[model samples]
Target: MITSQTLRQESEQPRKCFVVGPIGDPHAAHGSPEREAYEHHLGIFEQVIAPACEKYGITAVRADGIAHAGDINEQICRHVVESHLVVADVSSGNPNVMYELGLRHITGKPTIHIGEAGQLPFDIASIRTIRYQRTRSHLAGARKEIESALEVGLRDGFELLTPARVLRGLQSGDGPASVSEIGDGANREDEDSPGLLDDFAVIEDGLDDMTADMEAITKTIETIGSLTEQSGAEMLDLSEANVPMNARLAAVARYAETISAPAGELNTVAAAFAERMVTMDSGVRAALGLIEMTPPDERGEGTEEFLEQLMSLDEAAQESLAQICSFGTSAGEMARMSRYLRKPVKEISAAVQQLTSAITRMGEWAAKARALAHSSAT
Candidate 1:
């Protein structure tokens, strides 16, 4: 019953900005030059970039730094779309970095661009990119400039700061294609800044999107639970239906020692099947309990650990689902065997009644034959 609206309200809490940059393994086939170039950049990110973002009270994360198992590209894209701000390192002009930066542009949210000064491609060269060199001094200067830009951008709500947004504003500008850039280029005797608007719009959009994802995950979990319960109920019903078969099977052994072989065979199969079901059911129940133990509210200190465990429960649930399907198949085979044996059991019962009638008729026929023989002899 936790609705999307409730989730949205909960997600109103701010999270880290995503830093889009190229930091994959340097030793990759991209050559020693590229490797040496971006290798130290990771450190720069931690020391300068992260600290700058933190100054604005926003946590910053780089793609490789996230501890998750999924498609890396997907995670990066999602982070870019949902993050409070995107700080793109356009230094090496790496394809991946540029791709992510393009996505950020499409959102038109608060984004800060930075790169090495002389290396920028002409395509984006005109944009006011905070440039830095490899030297620590330039790194320090870049941090200061970026920190100031983030503060101002956050304040202005980053409405018209993207390439496309700038173009659109120009297409409609009554003043002129004036300011050299889109944003707090406001004070620039050059760049055109989109005048102020409500600061709440972009935040609201991100919240709505994040909340929708939460709602979808919630629905999936609920569906898995429901299906598990239904399968369990069906298995239980089948177990009850087998009670008569169990009794009849036990009677088979008691009625004739020779029948004990087949009866034991059936019993062995039944016991094995039951044991598997018990084990599978226990696993499913444990997983369900694990999920339940995670509180609706945050678990505070152990929250991350609990959430990780919670994600692992999906594997258990999947295993249970497979077992239930197997169980259904085994049960079907048992039902089929029972069906096949029914005719023989019924025929045996009928033949015993006929046997008793035959014995009575033979006794009467023998008595008449003996009397006729005696009369003939006299």
Candidate 2:
């Protein structure tokens, strides 16, 4: 007895989508690299993501566009969890972008990934990323690809990603699968399963990112420290040789310029890593809450499998924790050597502190998970 108007109303999809990616430095001087990066990413949002979303009556909002003045991280997390859809630019594998994407994935909502043609990370290379060059033709094609992907997502509804599927006891013994296997809406599961598995997947991915970023950070700090030491030696040699004051000053200026890019990258990545660690801690707490609320009888026959998965995650976290702790100690030493690079070093120290705290919380969650599984097994 339902009319066409009523059917249309019932089938209407939500129209808000949050975009996650690098926005670059807005206050960077004109004609600088930072300014150019800002413009380039902004161009992608306006010329690509916006037009594609407009086709489906969706409004795309970036984190920077929010008009409110509360905590930016809080606002971003809210949009990530509450929005009907999320589109993440995975180019350069930015840590903050990955963390936000992980958050969205935990919700099992509609999400999309896009990136520049050659910059996608190897870890996520198999996922369906809408790759685009800056050329007009490529950008146009990318926009169409996004629209088509969105059309499919809207029609078929959100399916579980690989990590979520495996943790939910839905898919057994599979490593991270390609987007075609899980992301294309081919495999749908029961909605009654506990959401704890979702948080597990999020933490799994976040830990992987944390480990990788920490290694990169360690290498960067070492390189900066070495450069600073070498530059000091060169300056001393120039002075001892009675080099002109103007020439020495010019050499020092050149050395500063050489150090600038890596220093800036270190700051950006460290800040993002700190934010992600905070989010990871929240995920751990949420998982522990789920463990407390889920009774053993409700887990059915999959309790053992769930325990195995929980143990696997704990092992992986332990391995990553070792690497992180090593980096934390080495980075502090390197920072002491290169005191001129204070800003980025400070950020690294802060990130290391936050990550350690998050891992400690994760250990607590693991203990609770083990106990829960033991109760179910007995």
Candidate 3:
């Protein structure tokens, strides 16, 4: 399993553009659950997206090809949030793909959407999907269109209002801001100097660092899972056996020690994640602040859509970190009790129960956060 740490860049790297869409291969027939669709998508990616990226010196990749062995959700979050560009195929409105596309939409970045003419959902049907027919003869044209879209998107797409922004404006009674209303100017002193969307490189780097921290924390969670699973049988047997209470207490303490090392490691990862969350959230707020400089006619309703999502993500991350600390604290306390207690009468039961409850609740919290983090649509 390769963690993000292994993939971290020590120096500047080419901007990345992630390909989002269904990669499933169905077998049997058209519209059948067994129909294979990945090959079709891959061809488009290889022919269209890859060439487009190369022209701009950007690297094109997809979620499946990522070499990391951490939480799949974490990996996707980094890509959707940090990628300089995204080319999504709404060929079927596949729920997961749409969810990712929805997340990308909230970013208000350069996103080029393409779909088969007949497969687009009603909500997005009029959004100018680059229509493509699936045929060998038409493949070239489709690829060219995609390349053209990339060129156009990279040059001016960032200034466009995302669907989220449009919807948000209506919901908040801010009235819609047309694409032309927003000016092309950005902070001049930025590293993307003279390029407004260029600071995304900084955002990308920050998210990548956060990804590394998340991957590390997830690995420790896996370790804890293993330890807990392996010890479950022993715990049950000890509960059933008629051993001395002190012996049983010592046994539980020993069991607690088994997870102490991994728990401590997780604690460190949690702290790192918390710190990164604060930094990342601050950067996002700053980006919003910069965008807010445009006059009311140009500024699209305060960028609250993006701000709200980032804030939700930030709050969840902090909660996850706290849950991790709870687990670590329980483990530490158990280990200490084992070291200091000569004989356990009542304290042992309390410590054991506390550790068990903490581990269970931590798992629950992690699962919920992972689900939310993975879905931009939510």
lDDT of 1 by residue, 166-196 (tens): 3233333333222223222223322343311
Candidate numbers, best TM-score first, in rank order? 2, 3, 1
In order, what is each prediction's RMSD in angstroms? 29.4, 13.6, 17.2
Best by TM-score: 2
Model 2 TM-score (2 dp): 0.51
Residue 106, model 3, lDDT: 50
- Work out the TM-score per prediction: 0.41, 0.51, 0.43
Better of 1 and 3 by lDDT: 3
Q: Give per-residue lDDT, candidate 1, residue 304.
A: 34
Backbone clashes counted, model 1? 5
**Model 2 stretches with alpha carbons more than 4 Å out:** 1-14, 172-192, 197-378
**Could you tell me the TM-score of candidate 3?**
0.43
lDDT of 2 at 71: 82
Cα-lDDT of candidate 2: 0.67
Q: lDDT (CA) for every model shown?
A: 0.50, 0.67, 0.56
Best by lDDT: 2
